[model samples]
Target: MTAPQRARSAQPALDRVDRRILDHLADHGRSSIADLAEAVSISASSAQRRLRRLESEEVVRGYRAVLDPIAVDRGLVVHLAVTLVDHTTNTVGRFERHVLDLAGLVSCHHVTGDVDYLMRVDVADVEALDVLLRRTLARLPGVARLTTMVATSAVVDRVTQV
Candidate 1:
């Protein structure tokens, strides 16, 4: 996973201590407050306060445990470029709602140019992928066309740095 990225434009500027705290947490979300304080050369209470502020400001959204897809029988990763038959607001809304909870979907991005949405799907194998595409994805509302590609390798997967 990449490091936690710097706060967005609307957020207040992060000082050196805040950056250190974020950097440490990005690498080790499971670390205790004492550990974080020690790493950032601050007190435990200070670390807690800073973390609270970050969370309240929506800077630190949440923490998650990263899992290995292969270990979980979801090794196959496919990218789909989907084009919608129409761009009506209602159609797009329905389409978005439909894909939001798909079982194997990892990410969905509303994109510009040739495609309406780009999706990352993970499954056990090509056979499973075929079933998903043929039975479900291809039949999704507003879907007019789709181009699929399987990923052979991943070169980088990191959290953005502070």
Candidate 2:
């Protein structure tokens, strides 16, 4: 099966109330149960119950502080189109495991395309990216080739809305 197809097939359906809770939570991750209840027009206990359900179901993965990358100095974003030396399962698994230990790896997707994987990397600058590509990614096992595209600007970066 295609990678996108697999992702689409795995999404669980959410009801109206569940969607409302998610929307509110997306806007305010640190919102109290009482506050969420008020926003969603439900009782505190009910909101708590639904929140628990969302967590258990993996609908709400985890809460995190979304900081400005530029402010922290890791502003440069690069999307790498990577081709593997082989299409073997072992090679793919090894590559995946190895990239996890890499410092600049933002996200990696095993994709169905000319390239075996697409990786998003964030670094402090072009020099840092050059070092990453040379010292880290290029030397990784099973990496046949890599094409890097620097993102000049992010037109849209958002969480999935309910």
> RMSD in angstroms, all models?
5.7, 3.9
Clashing pairs in 1: 1-158, 1-159, 2-158, 2-159, 3-159, 3-160
Q: Write the per-residue lDDT of candidate 1 for residues 16-118, one digit (tens) a residue.
A: 9999999998889989999999999999999999999998987799997777777776788888999999999988998999999887888899999989999
> What are the TM-scores, per candidate, against the unseen true structure?
0.83, 0.82
- Please identify model 1 stretches exceeding 4 Å from their true place: 1-10, 158-162
What lDDT tens digits, residue by residue, belong to model 2 across residues 69-115? 87766789889999999989999889998999888677899999799
- In angstroms, how far off is 65's CA in candidate 2? 1.1
Top lDDT hit: 2
Which 10 residues in a row give candidate 1 its minimum summed lDDT? Answer: 1-10
What C-alpha lDDT do the candidate models reach, one value each?
Answer: 0.87, 0.88
TM-score between model 1 and native: 0.83
